[model samples]
Target chain A: MAIDAVIPFKPKNPKTRLSCVMEQEERETFARAMLADVIAASCEGGCSPRLLCTAPYLHPTAEVCVDADGLNESLNRVLSAASSPLLIIMGDLPLADGAAIRRLVSTEADMGIVPGRGGGTNAIFLRHPGRFRADYYGASFLKHMAIADEAGLSVEVIDSFRLHTDVDEKEDLVEVLIHGRGEARRCLQSLGFVLSVEGGRVGVERRTHKETL
Target chain B: MAIDAVIPFKPKNPKTRLSCVMEQEERETFARAMLADVIAASCEGGCSPRLLCTAPYLHPTAEVCVDADGLNESLNRVLSAASSPLLIIMGDLPLADGAAIRRLVSTEADMGIVPGRGGGTNAIFLRHPGRFRADYYGASFLKHMAIADEAGLSVEVIDSFRLHTDVDEKEDLVEVLIHGRGEARRCLQSLGFVLSVEGGRVGVERRTHKETL
Candidate 1:
């Protein structure tokens, strides 16, 4: 059976870290672009993606589950009712492609974790959904591993650069420009963001002074 | 029993890619620092680390295995005669600390692979050694996965930024400066390399013009 992927998204005020370089609307657009990439990659990996949005939002590719509660509460609500395998991935991993998604879903363990930079749990694959619960934020990777152990579920950790590089800080935009190939990259490029090298360091620079605020 | 870690080291002409920024001797010194860091991390993770050196070199900590053959041939020679659980990790992953090593050694699967940035296997944890051979070049991550599947051994992929970020190119030095806390970072800093921003991109720059070449 096809694994169901639930991507939790904050429709309002997303990507706030990019506020120094991107306007509010631009951040929203970029967030949606990343979400689109995630959904497309999930589908390509033979899984049906469903967006767990905090607010009402429209996406043509995936199903939307609107729940205004906190992340852990809402995700557990979904988990409690899940019957088959579930893949929970963040919306900001623009570098993740079908290959990464395929590896996550193909794990034989009861639970699989793809940890993000700075001890964050970016993506998770659960064979038996209700057997595990979600607990994100602040070294959540270690917390999730503990949760799995407490539940008596066998766990596997996936060490992937593409899956772990979740776009958050403005500096992280460089990775998207370097490795991303979806609408997110186009959105950044369309906004005049280009890769620049300053004193031997690779970063992003805006060529044009057009602000959309 | 504690897992035995085998770290391959090339004593002569190592890290040639950093030749533009670092001299040959400096590269060798930096490589040794990284090796020292890896050995320390392995020991801290409760594993006995052995340095698989291309030439006879002295390490204060780990035992040395002198093998003049190429990487594949030498590692295979060791893999063919393995007894207990073994961990094969590259010496270039200086950012990998005790926690990362601990996670790698604690996996429940037959084999756990930590892949490098570009389809390279950086580390492998094998429960039953001699069952799986070592293949370490050009998309060896995927190749190892296939080999495991062919051998009917279950596999788990560990997605870790510190473990996957192997220092190969000169640009990779930035990660060492940012996240590293060992002799490798100290070596780079002692060589006058500092984090600099070029047109908004983060990179390494030499503040002092003390060329060792």
Candidate 2:
């Protein structure tokens, strides 16, 4: 059976919550950089994923399949159209390496769900793509698990900290900087990113250097 | 009915998890600053209980009573010694203000349990201090709740994000830098702490200034 990968990319106004700390342009830039890293990791894991973008945009590293709908609908469309086994991965996991992806897809179960931090469904591999619909609502990992159980499909629970820690909050960026060595890290470094220690805890701080006249 | 706030502080090895990002001297300084802020907030809420420390150290603002023991034992000692109502508050809650403290102590229950983010007992207000002991181990919130239940005491669960977000990990520094505007923030600022954005998220970064010839 052929197995394909599907990555949902939201390039337009991505990481809006991060706008509390990053400007619009910077947020978009950082989001694309993370997407690039995710794409690279997926490719290295031996699965050329169909990049499903929310809006039409040029991905320098991967091909785009625009789906101008919400997350569940967009993902459902891709799964519905698929004729073989598929792996769905979120495009924000900066620490998603080849080994992690391989471990996730190498599961024996017909359906595998990777739980994210804070009750999110980070990645899922399905042998019957058309049979299962995507549900990305609150506490989605449990919901997806229930879905597989109700469907009477063998489900494997894939729990990896690196795969689970998807970049969502401002604090999450600290993890990326600490553990990540990819396009996202390079993008942050180019934008003058550095680690800051506050209240005996570590965080990220940006420094802009100006030429002295 | 006097409400006293007993803040358990470990100044020697405060926030050791943050050792991944902060130096020993820096951690000590920052921990003390956070403790000072917690003390000020507690005092403003009309509770000027003794600051319990594991080691003998002079606090610039709050009076320190050295316990020279571990957490549960030292706290039990203080609870046993106390004759009236006492509130135990952790020293690392940088976002804790007077209002949150007032809310916590104002509860009508005989025993109040304030929960931390990751299954920690952040603060507890005991109307009958001598009647109950504290269990501040892993997942101590549930243990404290069980203790209250077994004692047949009226338990009030005080849920406050400000009180819950303790400065335990590196990412926790983000909460302090974003929402905190007290001694802890000032201490970090004095040590060249600033905000940085990477991967569309916020973090704290330090920038040291050097003198040139």
Candidate 3:
């Protein structure tokens, strides 16, 4: 059976942390490119991709489910109704590819999780979806582990560089440019973003400045 | 200056979880082999390996610091007195290699952590050891993150499979057999341990069981 992959995305005000380097409109476009990459990866990994968007939106590849509620509430609704195994992958992980998705879903455990850079959960694979609930926010990775333990479910943490690297800040753009192989990289490159090395540190530098009014 | 790699190990009654699969003496030998692998990796990664054992022990390639006062206390003692960057890697991660260690210490953040399969912290690279303390045990990964946040330290979580996979159970031996290139793997294979596939699940089976009394 094909696992259901629920990708929760905020259509409005997305990638706000990248505001220092990208304009509001560019952030939205970059976010969509990332979403597209995730959806494609999900499909290639033998799962059905469904976008749990904050607002009404359409994606050609994935099934769209709009929810006004926050990330936790929105995911809980889908999780409660899930009949089979479900995978919840954050849309911002542009570096995640088909291989990373396959590695996560192939784990032999009741629950598989990929923790993000800080304390966020980048992706989760739940065998018994009805028995678990999503509590995404600060330290959600730890919270999810506790929730699974309380429910008497076995948890396996999938540690992968591609799955854990979520593009949030401007510094995160360097990874996407270096390892990304999808629309997200093209979008960033098209926007004149280039890698800059200063004092043995790599960061993104915008080559073309947008004209101000 | 070479970074100080402090490896916290319990020399006595170590690897109690693997007792079901191995005898007391076998577990001790296995634990030592794993520790040797980690120490070698640390040295190859440009850090000075130091075993912070619960009991007195000696190694040819690394220094040994015996502190019977539990894991947290012993590690904090070293962390408090450290004048340079310090790394703490669990002794059971036999799959972790020099590249894994290099990837962790190369991070630009003040702290870099590799979370174990469960909530445990497998490896930590602390740039400012005095500003932080060691906290191992249940959910130590999250606790360390909180501690770093309180100290106003930038944290980078290095998500790597080899670093995160620690040998605690009989099933974990499969990973060492598959990906390990160290004394631990040779020790396991020498004991006639081989991968056993039962119902599409991989496990370990002792080919030559010890003669019964």
Ten contiguous residues with the weakest lDDT in model 2 chain B: B204-213
Looking at model 3, how many pairs of residues clash? 0
DockQ, all candidates in order: 0.11, 0.02, 0.07
Q: Which candidate comes out best when scored by DockQ?
A: 1
lDDT measured at residue B22 in model 2 versus the true structure, 0 to 100: 80
Choose the strongest candidate by lDDT: 1
Model 1 agreement with the true structure over A82-186: per-residue lDDT tens digits: 998999999999978787789888988998888776556889999999999998876577679899999999987775678888898887887787667899999
Candidate 3: global Cα-lDDT? 0.84
Off by over 4 Å in 2: A211-213, B1-213
**Model 2 lDDT per residue over B1-213, tens place:** 447788888878778888977899989999988988888889877788578888888877666799888889999998999898899999998878887788789899998776765446789999998888898765577678888888788987654556766887776776676557799988877877666666534566777765211
Per-residue lDDT over A50-154 for candidate 3, one digit per residue giving the tens place of the 0 to 100 score: 899999887776889999997898899999988999999999988777877997999899999987754568899998899999987755676788899999999
lDDT of 2 by residue, A45-100 (tens): 77886788888988665668898889999898888888888999998988788777
Error of 3 at A146 (Å): 0.5
Clashing pairs in 2: A170-B202, A196-B204, A196-B205, A196-B206, A203-B204, A204-B203, A204-B204, A205-B195, A205-B196, A206-B196
* Reference-based TM-score of each model: 0.60, 0.52, 0.56
For every candidate structure, what is the RMSD over all alpha carbons to the true structure, in angstroms? 11.0, 17.4, 16.1
Residues forming the 10-long window of minimal summed lDDT in candidate 1 chain A: A195-204
